[model samples]
Every structure is written in structure tokens, then in C-alpha cells.
Target: MAGASVKVAVRVRPFNSRETSKESKCIIQMSGNTTTIINPKAPKETKSFNFDYSYWSHTSVSQNYFKKDIKMK
Candidate 1:
């Protein structure tokens, strides 16, 4: 079980290992270890929505924003 007010991030660096030399990445924003991955398959620098999650969280609140368990609903 996980705490209701906890926010843990699980990141997976999946290797292409195929013809494509690009090493892909996968990021997941887990809520209480629930593993609700938003972009489990996204091209990091090439993706347009990369800033959709991290950007808003950083720009919208202070470092202590988690003090209230705040999230973009």
C-alpha cells in the first residue's frame, strides 16, 4: 500500500535495440504507487507534449506545493 499523499515517479529507459539507433524513454507519474503512466512511450526531446506535465507542475507552484498534495485536476 502507498500513502494517499505520495507522488512517486517511475522511469523506464527502454532501449530500441532495433534498427533505430534512438534510445527511447518512458516516464510515469505514479500516484500513491498506482502507476498511472501518462507517457510510457514518448520521444523525450522530440515530443511536443513533454512539457505538458512537468512544465505546469514546476511553473504553477512552488517547491513546497506538495505540502498540500496539489495536482492539476
Candidate 2:
């Protein structure tokens, strides 16, 4: 059998009601294919990761996932 590569992606969702009630802020930011996560407790600390695709579901605008973006052999 031929070796296959797996594609990975990340999706961000809006805060829940409980989180919003606590006045929590979002610390996730996506730029191009990179996603950055900042530590809320430690503002100076941050971590970034890259993915094949990313979906942001926290906005009012509509988003669609295109099938052409994924290629299978």
C-alpha cells in the first residue's frame, strides 16, 4: 500500500454563554494559514501553529468550505 498524508485543520467557534457572562475575551487570531493563540493568564506568552485550512465561526459573516481546496490521490 502507498503511504498517505493526512490533512489537518482548525476551526474556531464563538464563546459560549457561560464564557461571555464571565467577560472572557477571545485570544485566538488567524492570519492566512497560521493560527496564533495567546495565553490569557500570561499575556506575554503565545503559541502559533499552521494548518492546511482554518474556519472562523465567530463572525457575523457567512463562511463556506470549498471542496476544491482538498485534493485526494
Candidate 3:
């Protein structure tokens, strides 16, 4: 296991029916290799994490883009 590198990724999924019904806003955001999550109670409070990759699948358009991007890579 010496000299082995680890890769990690995070994805944001679309809201479910329950969440949609409650009109919940997405608190997660992804850009390049960074993923950020904002605190609902405090909009200014946000935490960002870096990974090998970051995916956005919270919408149909993003899902399609992700699929195409993966295939191209």
C-alpha cells in the first residue's frame, strides 16, 4: 500500500418528493473539485471541501452533462 494515492468525489442528488413538497432549497454547491454546503440557519455560514472530482446531479441538465463529461474523460 506504499505510495498509493487516494481519490475521492462527491455528488449532489436531486431532491425527493418530500423535499420538493416542502419547498426546500438546495444547500449544496459543486464547482470543479470543490463542494460547498451552506447552513440553512445561517446563509453566510458555508463549508467547502476539495476532492478529486465534484459532480452536480441535482437537476436533469446537470445529470446529462455529467454523463457526457464522464464519457469524454
Candidate 4:
């Protein structure tokens, strides 16, 4: 059998109640299979990475449902 590449993903969750109360902001964004993270203190300095999948679930229900269907080796 041929060697296969390992699949990877990035999951970004929104701030919870406590964070919201503190006025925290999200500096991450996902586009297709690419995820970009921006420095909160230095907005101009950003970094990006690519993954097989990206999940942006702001709620527990959505995140739990997505996790249930994922199969890991």
C-alpha cells in the first residue's frame, strides 16, 4: 500500500460568556481550508495556515454535532 498523507483540520470557537463580558474579539478567520489568525495587539501582523478542513462553530450544539460525525484514525 502507498503511503497516505494525514488529514488535519483547524477549529475556531467563539468567545464564551465570560470572554464576551470582557469585550473580547475574534481575530481568526477561515476561508475554504485556510485559517488566518491575526494578532489582536498588532492587527497588521497576521499568520495563515492550511488544513484539510476548517470548523467555525460558535455554539456548543453545532460543534458537538460536527464532532460526532468525524472519524479519526
Candidate 5:
């Protein structure tokens, strides 16, 4: 890894829209191996809601309970 000039990994997580009805648009940009996630269509948060996007998401639960049907969904 001596001559490495770019990041080894790039991870991104999209915004959870279930908390509110308003939708959002996001744009992802990458240059020189650097990636940036931008939400160009960011909407206003009008109400209070709790969404579990951390660890207990649907995809994770399905993966843990059923390992054969996971495809990054």
C-alpha cells in the first residue's frame, strides 16, 4: 500500500424518506478517487419522526434472519 494515492474505501448512505412525506434528490460526485454525496433536492423537515437507519434497518434484519436473499436492497 506504499504507492496508494486514493482512498481504499468509499461508503454512502441515502437519506431515509419514510420519516416525512417530502422527497429528496441526491447527487454523488467522485474525483481523483474521492467521493462526495450531495443531496441537491433536500427538503424541509416539518414533523417529528423516528427512523432506524442505524443497524436495525430492514436490509440488516433480513440479512441476519435470512442470509440467502440479501442484495444490498
Candidate 6:
């Protein structure tokens, strides 16, 4: 690990069969190295977190995109 620190990378995936069938909604949003999660029960409530890396594979899955952003010391 870089800097001997724990690196957290959040990757959201496409809904699976069950979720698709149930029409589940995604409450997660990512921008830069920040991730915001919405409360399902309360729309007004949300929590944001910062991490070493955040991969938004849910929208676009490109190996090059991931490789380009991720770094190793």
C-alpha cells in the first residue's frame, strides 16, 4: 500500500437480476475522491466520505480509466 496506509476504493456495480427486477434505486454518488451515500428511508439525509480512490465503474467500465487514475508508490 502506498504510504503504508489503507486505501479505500469504492466501485459501484450494475444492478443484478434481483435488483433489476425489483427496480432498486442507487443512492450512491461519487465525485473526485469523495463518495456520498443517500439514506433510503430519508432522502434529505446523506453522508459523504473521502478516500484514496473512487472508481465509478457503475456508469462506465474502462480498464484504461481505472489504470490511469490508480497509482502505486
Strongest candidate by lDDT: 3
lDDT of 3 by residue, 11-51 (tens): 77788999999999888766667667889999899998988
For model 6, residues 9-58, the per-residue Cα lDDT tens digits are 77767778999899898787766677788899998899989888776655
Greater lDDT among 1 and 2 belongs to 2
Candidate 1 per-residue C-alpha lDDT over 27-61 given as tens digits, one digit per residue, 9 for 90 to 100 = 43323223334445452423222222221232223
For 1-70, candidate 5 gives per-residue lDDT tens digits of 8986642343335457663355543344333333444445553422222222212122233332222322
What are the models' TM-scores?
0.21, 0.72, 0.75, 0.69, 0.26, 0.70
Better of 3 and 6 by lDDT: 3
TM-score of 5: 0.26
Name model 3 segments beyond 4 Å from true. 60-73
Worst 10 residues of 2 by lDDT: 64-73
The CA lDDT at 33 in model 3 is 71
Candidate 5: clashing pairs of residues: none
Ranking by lDDT: 3, 2, 4, 6, 5, 1
Candidate 4 C-alpha lDDT tens digits along 1-73: 5997899877776778999999887777666677778898899999989888778675453433233433222
C-alpha lDDT values of all predictions: 0.33, 0.69, 0.70, 0.68, 0.35, 0.68
Q: What tens-digit string does per-residue lDDT give for candidate 2 at 1-73? A: 5898888888777889999899887787676667788898998898989888777765443333222232222
lDDT of 2 at 11: 78
The better candidate by TM-score, 1 or 4, is 4
Clashing pairs in 2: none
In candidate 6, residue 67 scores what lDDT? 36
Ranked by TM-score, the better of candidates 1 and 3 is: 3
Positional deviation of residue 52's Cα in model 5 after best superposition, in angstroms: 28
